[model samples]
Target chain A: MNEYFSDLFSGAKSLLVGLSVTIREMFKPVVTVQYPREKLEITPNFRGHTELVKDPETGTHKCISCMMCQKECPSDCIRVKGEKREGVKGLALVSYSLDFTKCSLCGTCVEVCPTAALEYSQEYELAGYSSDEFRFDLLKRLEER
Target chain B: MTPEAAKQDKHTFVLNMGPQHPSTHGVMRVILEMDGEHILEPEPVLGYGHRIQEKMGEARPWPGFMPNTSRMDYLSAMIYNHGYVSLIERMTGIEVPRRAEFIRVITDELNRIQSHLLWLGAFLLDLGAFTPIMYTFDDREQILDILEDVTGSRLTYCYHRVGGVARDIDEKFVERTRAFIARLRSRFKPIYYDLVTSNIIFIKRVKDVVSFTPELARRYGLTGPPLRSTGISYDIRKNEPYSIYPEFDFEVPVGTKGDCLEVYNIRVAEMEQSLRIIEQALDRLPEGPFRNKIPRKVKLPQGDATFSVETARGELTYYLVSDGSDVPYRLKIRVPSFSNLSVLQELCRNMLLSDLVMSLGTLDLVIPEIDR
Candidate 1:
């Protein structure tokens, strides 16, 4: 009978201690950020997807179509097509397509670009119904910019 | 008698748990032969999450394989990232800067803490406790926020590069990490000790249940916390000191009984040790270039190299064979979960079905790592 009382007392003590933690946490503010209603403030280094950097003065992309990023890409997601212009010795940018579906976003393309033409976009709300929407024409996006 | 009737035993039954069950963590099916609530045999069916990551490694250049390493063990991706980069670095004899080494240690320890916290919450949830996971996630969010500030991704972070980290850590990152350490020490530790570890119901469920002897652990080749719980004290960080682990001073907590409760204790103790390592790394952080200028196309001489790191799950090893080309000739990964999950067949013999769940939960099997 004495041993049973001791067991009951110890159990009650542990219960009180557990309840104290729950009660304390109840007063703390909720950590959930309601998505769609409110979005998270992403960090500066967030890598969303690849984009072509537009040269403000030239009104064209800085990519020389060197095929460096295409070669460096692991997933074979980048497709670059360009040829040397009429009098220009270097290749000019024509059509640059990136299949966002296969791209792993490892920043290798941005790191390997010699002309600093590639940068990561901050756009995070990237959802669409069709797969065609993910195949981005990066040169056209730069032209729009 | 018909073949179907002949195969059916009078007192034994078959039960299948998951491939989609919540307690399986990932898509893994366990085929259990049961005698009315007591498990006779437990056979784990893998390959549900297999993506053939090793075959994918041979198709890409050395630098391109970094993204795939993190997907193997999503909870502790940074450690795997470090493992793959360090493997190439070892083969080529690349000189990683001192600051980069410190950054690797800090982030690795932080990732360890996060992984252990998730396990703690999920393990308790498997045992019918629901409220604790919210608290664990609250702590985990702070870790994700801090890691995201630099690594750029939350879950599957590809942060480490060949010679160094992709980016450098600033004064803000250091200050924020120190603040987090203090918060965990002051607010989180006491609550966990009081509420979960000491509670009578939790103790009754785990203590002296599903014990593994040291011989049994050695026979199964278990590593990390599960092995330590058997009192082997063979931590890869201590026994085979890699990186800057030799500089840190921390105790390897071992258990004599090797039960479910002991596993919980060892994991909690490891979180404290990880915090200590992080604090020490932050204090002695050197100032130098974060990344070395490696070639745009990394070409290695003909050689094979193997490098292993103590990930949160266990020992994750990467073996790379370079045939003097940009792409690897053969890439092999020895994941910890594959060996850790193999012990379950021996562990669940003639145990209650509920005890089998507790045993599997304590082992902390991440199925994708096993499947890979």
Candidate 2:
């Protein structure tokens, strides 16, 4: 009886302390949102990953595929094919493919680009079915809506 | 005179604390010279299992190299991903899309809760409380499920990319996460307070014991949950304001006494704060590109840069140097657990050998993070 009474009082005290605090928290404002009902505003400096930037003037990328991105990529996710053109003075890009499966998104390639054509777009969703699907070609990235 | 000088003799007992001992958590060896049960001089022996991560970083390309960061601190792999991705983004000057930030916030918070839950369970176990472990896991399983659903890996998730996140959130994933967060909050809070906090044994063991002052906290460069507990309202998410943390409404819990109980209290409070941050992120989640547009064929210019992110353990800093090469010239990681472990020498000295376990556990030292 003595132990039971003590236990009850302690329990009551504990409840008072815990609930009163939680009650205070209730009025201050909820920290969580319904999520699907609403949306969050991402900061300007948020880092996601690398993407191909579109040229504002020519409606084309400046990637002549010098293979600087491929050479600088630590993960070797980037695979590029470049050849000298008859008329073009610089090397022209025939193909550029990025394997998302192995890409760490470190931005080594983007930062290294002298053309400033490669930009971080903050578009993050890049899951795929297989290694092949993960490989992104230049056409889709450059021309994507 | 020589005989009189020789009388100044003190006996020492050399004791091996870990590397495999239950208290050290993961492969930490501390040699203690003791006067019976009380530690006289404790020398921390490191490099029992040193993972050469920095060397690995030097070899791998920037984007491909991030998998190794998650492996360093295995517990908070999501936040580890968050840290590394943030650094790469900062160096490269890329911005994550609004939607990507929200997912990062949500996922990272889940990781924080997972870390704290594990800490609570482990800390209790260090104090000889077994039942709490089972209870913690029951709560943790739900979180693991949510994490595994999205990342396709449970423990070490390479979720974040340097430019953005790796995957998009489906309706099912978001719904399940919301449900799990609510359920775990209700369950864990009640059980933790009732089973652990209310227990007189626990209170007696933890309260007014192994106290760390704020001066000491700063001196040792302690960050994360323990640093907040010492009456310091320094949270990197709030102070530094990364991602979409500026929009979130949360409180950084401060404890008057920097004891084990205070650490416990702070972590519990932090779990709530992380929940709040998650809520704010979820509510304001944007719709757009999940990844940023950086062209293929990448290289960074010659530069030396330092990056700091708030990991669950503490402040994880990465210093990178590039010679305009594909590989980094030098890679250095300032891990939280390593600096946090320095304070343990002062804490455990002159205390009973048994309390050392509780002290170490409360600090939440991950050995790989320490050695790396």
- Per DockQ, the best of the predicted structures is 1
Candidate 2 lDDT tens digits, A1-145: 9988887777677656555545554575544457668765543333455567777887877887777788777677888887998997688777778877777655557766888767655554556676687677865777774
> What Cα-based lDDT does every candidate model obtain?
0.88, 0.77
State in Å the error of residue B148, model 2. Answer: 0.9
Residue ranges of candidate 1 with Cα displaced over 4 Å: A1-9, A86-89, B1-9
B10 Cα displacement, candidate 2 (Å): 3.0
Clashing pairs in 1: none
- In terms of lDDT, model 2 sits at 0.77
The residue-by-residue lDDT of candidate 2 on B221-320, one tens digit each, is 8777778778887877778777777888888788877888888888888888888787777767778888887755367668978777787788888888
State the fraction of real interface contacts model 2 keeps: 0.18
Q: In model 2, where do residues sit more than 4 Å from their true spots?
A: A1-145, B1-9
- Evaluated on the second chain alone, the candidates' TM-scores are 0.96, 0.95
Worst 10 residues of 2 chain B by lDDT: B1-10
Docking class of 1: medium
